[model samples]
Target: MPYYMFQWKYKNEAVKALVQTPQDRAAELRKVVQAFGGRLHEFFFAFGDYDGVSIVEFPNNERCAACATTLTGAGANDLFRTTVLLTGDEAKAALAMANATNPDYAPPTGYTHHS
Candidate 1:
């Protein structure tokens, strides 16, 4: 499964609705994501630019996209930014590959000049 980190900022109307029905919101989201074959891991209220952040797991990117699209279609119009998280091992592998770059590289112009 792939893990996703989503930060969401609710629209004014959705915020008002959520304020009036806070308890059911999580349950509703869980049900919807489950229907799309994704699992909602964490949902938290925040005190910054975004209203909440949710961590989710899905079989693939398509299922994750479906969940995001569903949220938008429900008239909530919540603005969301999602990032797919890679495991630590994957990150390490990528870093190692990147460090295997050309060893004969010469410094570019002005490299010897100090600011």
Candidate 2:
């Protein structure tokens, strides 16, 4: 499964709704994620440009996107962005295989040939 970081900012109307009732949105969001084959690992309400940040895990990017769409439809604010996250082990594996020293490989522009 892949992890994703979701950031959302509330529209004025959405803010009004939350201001009227500030509790349980995090819990509600977890339910939404679960419904879409994703799991909400962490959620935080912020005091900055974005209203909240959530870390979610899904079997694939499609499922992650579905979760985001569902949140939007459930009256979350607009302009949502999702960033895919690689676990430490996944990153390490990629790093190890990045350049396996294939003699026939040609480096892309500005990249130095590996010795």
Best model number under lDDT: 2
Off by over 4 Å in 2: 101-115
Q: Tens-digit lDDT track for model 2 on 1-115? A: 8999999998898888878977787798898888888888999989888888989899898888788887777765866889999999999888777757545765687987668
**Every candidate's lDDT:** 0.83, 0.85
Q: Which residue ranges in model 1 land beyond 4 Å of their true spot?
A: 100-115
- In the predicted model 1, the residue pairs found to clash are none
Give the C-alpha lDDT of model 1. 0.83
TM-score between candidate 2 and the true structure: 0.81
Tens-digit per-residue lDDT, 9-109, candidate 1: 88998888778876666777789889989999988888898888888899999999988888877766557888999899989988897788746767897
Task: Indicate the worst ten consecutive residues by lDDT in candidate 1.
Answer: 70-79
What's the true lDDT of residue 13 in model 2?
A: 88
